[model samples]
Structures are given as C-alpha cells and as structure tokens.
Target: MAAVLLTGTGVTWTYVASGGHRFDVADAPDAPVAVVFGAETKTPYLTGRLETTIALVKAGKVRSVLVSGNAAGSSGNETRAMTSYLLTHGVPMAEVVVDPYGVDTYDTCARAVQVYGLRRALLVTQPYHLPRAVSLCRSLGMDADGVNAQCACGGVNLFVNEAREWFATVLALKNAIWHRAPGVASLPH
Candidate 1:
C-alpha cells in the first residue's frame, strides 16, 4: 500500500515538474524544430494544441513541423489530421512531413530522429505524455524538449495517463539498451 502511494505520488510530481512548461514553438530560440504526435480520436486536446503549433510555423517562427502518427481509419488518421490542420492554417504542405507509421510515442520520436534526420526536436503533446516522449528521444540521441498541450479539463485527465507514462519510460529505456527500437519496419522473421 505504501509503495503504491509513493509511486503514484512520484509519477504525479514528475508530470507536474518536468511536464508543466508551456512551450512556445516560435519563441524557443534554441529549438528550431518541432514534432507533434497524433493522438487517438478521443483526444481533442491533442489536435487543438497541434493547431497552435502549426500557427507558429505559419507565422514563420518554427522552421519545420514534423507530424508523426498512424492513420488507421478514415477518422483516426492522426498525421493527416495534423497536416490538414496546418494546411488550413496556411503552413506550406511541403514544410509538414507526415509520418504514418508512428503508432506509439516511442516510435514517433524514434522515427523522427532516425528516419527524418532530426537532431533536436520540441515534442508537442499533453503534459502527462511529455516525460516518456522526451526520454525516448534522448535515448535515441536526439536532444529533445517538450511543450504541453492545453487541456480543457486541465490536470484532471492526467491521473491514469501519468502512471502509464512511468511504465513507458522504463520500457523505452530498456528497449533502447536491449532490443530493436520502435521506429524501424522489420524485414520480417
């Protein structure tokens, strides 16, 4: 019981401290690159914040925007959704790269760095998701920071996801050390 309480508290604080920075993509002087992952259909906060990031690029602040995620169905194509959002906002279609195979946070960051030649990236997502995403990017040798999406419900929705991220961080680090990383398409067994 005590262990559970401490672990929960630790995870909660990790989200609060490391994930609270509201990153302005255009204003981050050292951060010229930005990457936003596509969330599932229920996560409107993901798309809403993506629009803001696109606006930064449209305004000439961010040099490039990499939208990473899978397009599983007609409605759930996260990469396409992000691309369309950016296009509607006047960001050139050429400036946006759609990664259709990034099915997870680790894959999204890994593919962005390895396949896309990204050296440094500002990851955009909800606050609870920042830790795992940043860790995966670092594990893959990309200098990474994160910008949290503004949630309509604010911190309330983070309760369950924060725990999931803690486990994901451990798994991502282990995978970086032990197994094949997430982004590569396997040649087949």
Candidate 2:
C-alpha cells in the first residue's frame, strides 16, 4: 500500500510539474509557425494569453499565427475576435489565420494537423489546461511546446480543470485510435 501510494504521488507530481505552465518562448529556427487555441470569450486569463502570442508574432518569432476556436455565432468568431484584437495591438492582419470549426482541444489539434499541416507548435492555454493540450498535440505528431495564460481563476478552478483533463485525455486517445476521420491527409487546399 505504501509503495502504491508513493508511486501515485510521484506520478501526480510529474503531471503537476509539467502542467504549471511556462509562457517564455523558447528558441525556434526555421519552423516559426504557431497555432494559438482560444479560451472562454470574456476571461482575462484567456485574453492575456492571446496577447502574449500576438506579441510573439509582433516580435517576429512567429511567422504565422493560426487562431482556432468557436466561430459559430453571428455576433463574432472567437478566433477572429482574437485576431482583430491582435491587429489592434499591432500584429499584422496578414500574420493571422483562422480555424472556425475548432470547438474543443481534440478538434483544434486535429484541425491544426490535418487542415493546416502543422508540424510543430507552441500550445498556449492556462496552466491546468497545458498538459492535455500538449499531450494531444504531440500524439497527433506535432512537436509541441507550451506557453501559459495567466492563472486568474484561482486554485479551485485549477483543480477542477485538471480533473476534467483526465477524461479529455482518454477521449482524445480513443478518438485518435478508433474515431479519426478518413481523408485528413488528402484534403485539398
């Protein structure tokens, strides 16, 4: 029992340590393309993350920024709203691209890999959300890194979100193995 407990604790620590999130962009050469996934519409944490990614684009670290998120409403697309916000903040409109159908993490990574032909990316989201996103992206063949949004929602939100990620991870893995759509490779540009 003690051994089991210790092993579980170690595993938990590894996940937590990897999930704390880091925003400082690492060095990249040649492969400067990135895809920034969107968060909730009005969350400061999400907006702050979008801004950081835009700054990277503005600084020329990212040559292309693929904005993927909910874009179903008539009022505005979340990804487009993010792009517009970035443009207002000095990121060129030409640098921004949109994936209008990415309503979830699995779908977002799928779109990035299949539709955009993403070979690598810096997955940006909150700390608690990073591990699943990075893991899923990598599972789909993206040489993925992570950058974090600010953690303004506190510890309880973190705990709940992390718990939710376990289910997400399982679902994503299953989908990747058994439920993936055909023709992802042959889709026309």
Candidate 3:
C-alpha cells in the first residue's frame, strides 16, 4: 500500500512538473484562446475563472475564451452560467465559445484539442488545479500554459479541493498515458 501510494504520488508530481511554469495573468504568454474549466455556478470558483479570463483578454494575452463545462451536471448548466458570467463581466459574446460536453478536467482538455481545434491555449483555473489542467492539455498535443485564478475559498472547502488533487493527479496521469478520449459524445463541429 505504501509503495503504491508513493508511486502514485511520484507519478502525479512528475505530471505536474512536466507542465513547466505556471504564470500569473500579467506574465502569461499570448495564446489564441483562454480555456476556462467549469466550476459551480455563482461560486467564487466560477467567478475567479471568468475574472482571470477577462484579465487575459484585456491584457491581450488571448483573443477568445472557450468556456467548457457539463450542461447536464449537478452544477446546473455550467457552460451557460460561465458564458453569462463572462459576457456580463465585459468579455464580448463574439469572443466566447462554449463546449457543453466538458464533463471533467480530462474531457475539457480533450475537447479543447479534438473539437475546438486548439493548437495552443491558456488554461484558467484555480491555483490547485492549474498544474493538472496544464499537464492534461499538453498531453493532448496542445501547447498549454496556465494562469492561476484567484478564489476566496478557504476552510473545509479549500481543504477538500486540495486533498482531492492528489487523487485527481493520479487519474490525470492515467488519462494522459492511455490517451483516453472524453467519456461524453462530442457534438459535431
């Protein structure tokens, strides 16, 4: 058990390290799109991601935003909510692309490459999630960089998310190694 845990942790760390450097909004390189991963609607998680995306656009770091999320999930139409938030916060509607089948981190990364035809992207998510997002997207053959979105979350919620990343990282490595396609059927472009 100990060996398994240690090996998993090491593999996860390797994936995270393979992502290279994560940047803040100010230092992020120029990219064609900013891919905002989904979070619960109306939460700081969603807000921070949209806000960071807006910052990237405003700074001329990215030209468009791809909001990816599960429309049928418990988050209650995350793509819709994410699109609305971005638009209302001054991100132009013309610059927004929605992927409703982004049911998870791997799905989002996969769809970004397969469906959206993204060659490069700036991934926007909270700090804890940025590495995995970067690693997964890179594994899918996209030139992926990340910018940390600021969230006001703390206490038990933050603790749970941080803890979840360890297991999530292992899953990310598996997905990358096996070249797993997204579980959901993608809409035809």
Candidate 4:
C-alpha cells in the first residue's frame, strides 16, 4: 500500500509539475475552442471559468466556448444551466456549445476530442485542478493547454476538491492510456 501510494504520488507530481507555469487566461494558447469543464453552477470556480472564456471570446482569442458538464437528462442538466449562463453573459449563442455527456473531467477531455472534433483547445478550470485537467486532456490527444480560474470556494470544499483530485489524477493517468472504446462513433444514434 505504501509503495502504491508513493508511486501514485510521484507520478501525479511529475505530471502536474509539467504544467507548473499554468495560470490565468492571459497566457492560454489560442485554440478554436475553450473547453470549460463544469462544476457547481453558481460556484466561483465554474463561474470564473465561464467569465474567462467569455472574455477570451470577446477578445477574439478563441472562436468558440464549449461548456461540458452533467446532462442528467432534463432533471439535472448542468450543461443547460452553463449554456444559459454563457449566453446571458454576452457570449454569442452560436459560439456557446455544450457537451451534455461530460459528467467528469476524463469524459470531458475525451469527448472534446472525439465528439467535439477538437484537435487543439484551451482548457479552463480552477487552479488546483488545472494541472491534472490539462495533463489528462493532453494525454488524450488534444493539443491542449490550460489556464486556472480564480476560485472562491474554501474550507471543506477546498479540502474535498484537492483530496478528490489526488485519486482522480491517478485514474486520469490510467484512462489516458487505456480509455479507447467505441468512442465517439459509438454514441447512440
């Protein structure tokens, strides 16, 4: 158990560290799409990501914004809320796309490549999550770079997010290598 933990820690650190200078939307690479993975709708983390993406859109840094999140059909559609927020906030509706199937970061990364047809993209998310999220998206064959949004959630929320990210980093690494399935072609017709 100790060896496993140590190895996971080492791998995680190496991967995350590769993106050490990642921060802020100003430094993000210009891509056709800014892929903003979803979190709590009203949380500063998600909202800030949206705001950054919107600014990027207005600045002509990116041509479109892809808001990826939980669909949960009509009952729990985070994508709907996110799309609505982006549209209301001055992002052109034609430029605000949603990935309703992106229930998690891994799914978001994969779908961005397969479903959304993104070869290169700018990823936006909270700072604590930027490293792993950027790492996973890149490993999944996206020419992906990232910018961390400023987060306002704290205390237990912060602790839980960082803690969950540790294990999630490991899983993301695994999926990075072995997640090939029917892929985008297999989606229901």
Q: Please, what are the lDDT tens digits per residue for candidate 4 over residues 10-98? A: 46663664455465677666789889988866677777888878877877889988988876633346777788888898888888887
Q: Number of the top candidate by lDDT?
A: 3
Best by TM-score: 3
lDDT of 4 at 51: 80
Tens-place lDDT per residue, model 1, 116-152, is 8898777887766776676667667787777666666
Q: Residue-wise lDDT of candidate 3 within 20-87, one digit each (tens)?
A: 65899888889999999998888898899988898899899999999999888765889999998888
The weakest ten consecutive residues by lDDT in model 4 span: 180-189
Segments in model 4 whose C-alpha atoms lie over 4 Å from true places: 3-7, 10-21, 73-75, 180-189
Clashes of 3: 0
* Order by TM-score, highest first: 3, 4, 1, 2
lDDT of 1: 0.68
Clash number for every model? 0, 0, 0, 0
Candidate 3: minimum summed lDDT over ten consecutive residues — where? 10-19
Model 1 TM-score? 0.76
For model 3 the TM-score comes to 0.91
The C-alpha stretches of model 1 lying farther than 4 A from their native spots are 1-27, 73-75, 154-158, 183-189
- lDDT tens digits by residue: candidate 2, 40-82: 6666656877876865675676788888877763334677677
What C-alpha lDDT, on a 0 to 100 scale, does residue 20 get in candidate 3? Answer: 61
TM-score of 4: 0.86
TM-scores for the candidates = 0.76, 0.74, 0.91, 0.86
